[model samples]
Target: MEIYQAFLVALVACFGKFTGDIGYFMFDRPIVLVPLTGLMLGDLQQGLLLGAELELVFLGIVSIGGATPADVNMGSVLASAFAISMGAGTDVALALAFPIGVLLQMVKMLIYFFRATTMHKVEEYAEKAEFDKITFMHFGHCAIYVSVYGIIAFCSLVFGADAIRSIVEAIPQVVMDGLQATSNMLPAVGFALLLNMLWDKKLAILLLFGFVLSSYLQLPVLAVSIIALTIGLIMIAQDRSSSKTAVQTTGEINEEEDFFNA
Candidate 1:
């Protein structure tokens, strides 16, 4: 890869690394990151295709409460760079994604740990009322993160492209097929995680209902979604109405008892 291309990708990774929490620009998402990488490398479609696939794979792997689930954004950056550089199609890119994200997640976890150690310093600054020092430290933290990923991104471009291509080529045909198969299964695993965290039996029944409506009746997804939204709104309305009626009924009962007592 050209030096400029590598630098551009590192720049993208830098933006993507902190954009999730800091920038809130949505570039940290694979949907945006992949296309940006592809655009950087003059292969926008390649990036988009890869992005769409990775987006599904990591769909539910959101970071919450300072948890680093996986650095899937970094995976998107690396996988797209390697794929575009080596002309490895999206399937092969998908195969590499999870592993790459896992590796980058380690890096992210380490940063989070080290950053947590700086809380004492932040506390000291707060006690001293040194607000400027706090701002300085925050910027320093950002710079360190950007530089860490930027270096990784640059070096990957500088030295990792041929290695990744060779690794892809060295794998057996069956293994490659297996990788692709596993890649397809990732979305299912992601959904399973979603269910584990946010599952409700009632919602599961609703989900099954949607599945049946689509599969059996051949209803369009948008139509089914609209129906679901309408049902949800109606449920909310009914709950409010029921609560109000109970309140009114209790008020009438108390009024009747007071009249009898009087």
Candidate 2:
């Protein structure tokens, strides 16, 4: 990649981190970042396709509390950069993204680890009523967190791109096929993970209905979405009617009880 292109990738990575700091607008997602990275690299179409595919793999990943998921932002940026700049395929990008994300997640933990160790300073500031210093540390931490990822992005693209391309060129056909197969299966895995988190007995019937519509009846996604929306509206209306009836019944009972007392 050219120096300016590499710088742009790093800049995009910085923006990805910035989004998370400022209320998580989801600009860091693979689907969003990859296209932006691709645009910077002059391969928007490939970036878009790869970004869509990568989104499936990372779809179910959510960082709850202190837990860190893979660094999708870093992985998507670098993988798309390598794939675009090196003229590699989507499979290569998919193969590259997950491991890279997983590996970089450790770096994220280290950042968190150091930040955690500094809580005492914040505590001391709080005890001393140094609110300004505490505020300064918060912004400083955000800047440092964002810059570290940006530097990683820039260096990885500039320094590591050639090495990765060379390795990709040397890999055997069988291994490549395996990687492609795995890539194909990853979306299902992502969906399964998401379902595991969201599963409820009440929603199982709806899930099956959508599955049958899409799988058996060959209904398009738009049709299924509209059907689901209709069902949801019906359910909402039923609940509202039930609530009104119960309220009216309760009011009648209260009035009858007061009449008897009088």
Whose lDDT is greatest here? 2
Q: Top model by TM-score, which number?
A: 2
Worst 10 residues of 1 by lDDT: 18-27
The local distance difference test score of each candidate is 0.85, 0.89
| TM-score of candidate 2 relative to the true fold | 0.84
lDDT of 2 by residue, 70-134 (tens): 88767878887898998877789887887889988998888878889998999999999999999
Which residue pairs does candidate 1 place in steric collision? Answer: none
In angstroms, the error of model 2 at 119 is 1.7
User: Per-candidate TM vs. native?
Assistant: 0.77, 0.84
1-262 in candidate 1: lDDT tens per residue?
9999999999899888767646677679898898899999999988888887787777788878867676788988898789888887766877677788899888877886888899799999999999999989888887888789899889988998888888889989998778778878887886787778888876888889988999999999799989999989998999999999999999999999999999
Per-residue lDDT value at 198 in model 2: 91
